[model samples]
Each structure stands twice: as C-alpha cells, then as structure tokens.
Target: MNTTPPRVLTIAGSDSGGGAGLQADLRTLFACGVHGMTAVTAVTVQNSLGVTGFVEMAPEVVAAQILAVATDIGVGAAKTGMLASAGIIEAVADACDQVGIGRTGTTPFVVDPVAASMHGDQLLTDLALEAVRGLLFPRATLVTPNLDEVRLLTGIDVVDRAGQREAARALHDLGPEWVLVKGGHMWADPECLDLLFDGSEFVELPGPRYDTKHTHGSGDTLASAICSRLARGEGVVEAVRFGKEFVVRSVRASYALGAGVGPVSPLWRLEG
Candidate 1:
C-alpha cells in the first residue's frame, strides 16, 4: 500500500447540486491529489442554478463532526465555508483548538467568509459575522473574501487593485494571519486581480478574466483548492496561483444545469 502525501479537511456546508460547498471542496481536493474529509455544517436544497434553502446543523453537531474528523484520520489543512451562525463558528473554532493542527503545531485554516452563496442568497446573519470576526479569523491561516464579502466584512470598497490591498490589510487586522481580497467584481478590469496581504507585504495575483456567467461557487472552490494545495506543502502564493488556474478552467468549462446562473465545475480539469 502507498501512503497519500497529505490530508485535508473541509468544515463546510453541503451543496446538493454538487457544484460548491463541501462537495466542491472534496472534488477539488481529490483532483489536487490530496485526501479529502468533510464535516458538514449545513445542508442546502440547491442545484447548479442556485440555493433554494439551507438548514444549518446544530452547533453541537457541527462541533462533533469537527472532532470526529480531527481525532482520527487527520488533516494538514482545513477550510471553512458557510458557517450559518455565530454559535456554529464558535464551536468550530473551539474544536480546532482541541485537535491541535498537527506536527507543525498549527493547522492551516482557510476561511472563505461565506456570508452569502454565489447566487446572492443570504447565508450568514449579522450576528454570525460578529462571531466570525472575533472567534474564527484570529485562527485562520488565510481568509479569502470576494469584493462584496470584503466590503461586508471590512466595510471597505475595493473598487481597484490598490483598494483591494487596503481592504486586505484591514481584514488582516481583524485577525486572519493572511487575507486574499478577490477583484472579480471589477468588471471593467482586463483581468482577475487578487490581492493577498500577509501582515507585511501585499502580493497581487493577476489572471486573464474569462467572460462568462457560469461563475457560481468560484470563491469557495478557490479557497478550498488553495487549502488542498497548501496541505501538500505549497506556499501561500503558489497555492493561490494554482487555485486561480483551477477556478478559471472550471469557469471556462462551466455547464448549464438549471434556469439560472450555472456553477463552475471544480472538477473541470479532471472531467475534461
């Protein structure tokens, strides 16, 4: 038998559509050659079109799942998405502490501040945001937020690359060790510009923007991809580079599923 290189855990919600959330994370992780485990925080009645409704697991159940995974098989990196409430966020953070990140003594945590799903559906309430800012961010290795999420979380309008950098810094102050502010909303821009602030310097990642509406679940997929790569020992910048590529390809290969905006197939590279 051969041993896998590394393992990754995703503490996130489930997308019945199998396009995003824990499903997307799992596919991305597997596609990247990393072992993927999941602790589902919520369940969504959704499809490639959009999320119709979501039922958040109780905080206790959420914590139990985290422990169930953390206590056994193990993980090199973990990412969180769509924590629907403050109580759930708190439970997850506490569970992380108990698990002890591993031999390095700290687990790489990727927080995809998912207050809303890709279809603009509201997921996290105001109170949930509060718990995230205080309890979760401080422990996160990287916090990935798109333009709207950045504005909602930090109250900063990232209208340009420079603005994105400034917003990343603000989010860094909020506690995450690093922040990546995505610029997908800057439609006028020639490329997809993302800014990452690692407490000291700002790293800008630029990619050619694909002109398409099949961009649902992109942020979730990117963060999860980065986390999976990081679990395999890729540095932050390199992980983000691969993550962006994976997302772009997924978006380019996106397929229509329902009557609304379709989701980016995170497994596009493999399925192609």
Candidate 2:
C-alpha cells in the first residue's frame, strides 16, 4: 500500500482569520486528500470583515521557501495567491522555473489571481498586478480569476456568458494554457457558471447559486481543489469539474464565523 499522498504547494499569504489565503488552501488540499506545502508570501491582519494590514516576505525569502520544499519533498502541483508586490511576483516566477512547476515544467501551476479580499480590500499593488500578467501568466498552467480580477487584469467587465468568453480569450492571450473565468461575482446570474477555455475549446461548469454571504475563501477553495485533483493525476478539464463540484458542496455546507462573512467549508468532505 502506498502511504504517500500527492503533494501540492501553495505560494500564498496567511489569513490570520484562517478563512482564506494558504489556510484555506491547506484545508481544501487536505480535504481533497493531498499533502499541502507552503511558501508564505505575505502575512495579513484580517478577519471575516476585511484585511486591515499586511507584511510581505522578502523576495529572496519567498524564493528560498519554494526551493526548499520543492527540491527535497517534491511537488505534484502548486498554486499562488495574494503575492503583494512586483518583486515577490518576479521571485515567484523565477523560483517556479527553477523548480519545474509551471507551464513548461513538470508540475502544474494554478494562478488564483487574488487581487482583493471579498470585502473589497486591495491585497496586491498595480505593479504586482502587471508582474502577474507579464511574468506569472505565461508560466501558469491554469489562471483562475474571478470577475473583478478579470476586470483588473484584462479590462473586461464580464457581466454575462458572452463577456466571459471575451475575458477568457483576453486572458488566454496573456499566455496561460488554460483560463478559468469564475462567475461567482456575477450576482444577477441565476446559476453560477464558471467558464474554462484552453485556447481552442471551452467548457462551462454550472452550479447552483447558493444564497449565502459566507463565501470568503470560495476562490481559494476552488483553485486549491483543482490543484489537488491535478496532483492526483487528473487532466485539466476533469480536475476543474471536480473542483467545481467540491466548491459547490462546500458553499452549501458553509456556516457563519466572525462578525461579517464566513468561509466556505471543506468540512463537507468529512461528512458521512
């Protein structure tokens, strides 16, 4: 019996509230039966309400952390979130190349373009945003961005399916092999339809639109779930579909936490 599980690394920030960032990534990875590792990029003082402040890790330190785990334990897949600066983004890109963890590498890379908190607090600067577009996008195996991020990255305001396709094409032009335009922010839509495009074809993943405000870590959860499935050796489409189902169930099982919004629960995996 093989006791070792597939390993997935998260190059991200820490959410003091434990509702998002690498905290949520680890939870989702564990729930999906993958071993999770981390390269902390930033540490934020935040809760369900919003992010009050943050301190970013030095670029070299971030790179060292990635090299450390990836060289010794090995990574099956990896994902990124809340890289706070251009230097950090550049460092992450270079380290990812060194460790063979991106589009041209051995491991799959999931870029969860987390620009802001659910409460609309900015987590990344404009320069870092540019770096993510130029440096990380080309190296990403999959770039997963919600509507707001889509608007920020591609200047496309995706309000409907047509707009989603347009935004996906624009993001694809940035060089990721796959682009998942998450529609969770499309409040007017009856069903939450996440669009996936791989240059030539498109896959629409539709799910029930749950009436809940406790969706703080929803994006991180979905992206990490996809990374987990990829680490388990699933193909991109299959992995994304699995991720969709996983997040839907998580949101369905979501419960209130702090004074404001709560996190989407991966606890559904533990249910009998």
lDDT of 2 by residue, 1-272 (tens): 98999999999999999999999999999999999999999999998888888899999999999999999999999999988999999999999999899987989999998886574555577888899999999999999999889988988888899999999999999999999999998888999999999999999999999989989899999999999989988999999999999999999999899799999999999889
Instruction: Give candidate 1's error at residue 87 in angstroms.
Output: 0.7
TM-scores for all candidates: the values are 0.94, 0.98
lDDT of 1 by residue, 1-272 (tens): 89866888888899898777888888878778888888888999987667678888999999898788778777789988888888889888888888875222477888888885564445678888888888888888888888778767887877777787788888989887788888888777888888888999888788878877877778877987898788888788888888888887787877776877677886666764
**Candidate 1 lDDT for residue 99:** 89
Task: Tell me the deviation in Å of residue 244 in model 2.
Answer: 0.3
Q: Which portions of model 2 show Cα errors greater than 4 Å?
A: none
State candidate 1's TM-score.
0.94
Steric clashes per prediction: 0, 0
Best TM-score among the predictions, by candidate number: 2
Model 2 worst lDDT window (10 residues):
116-125
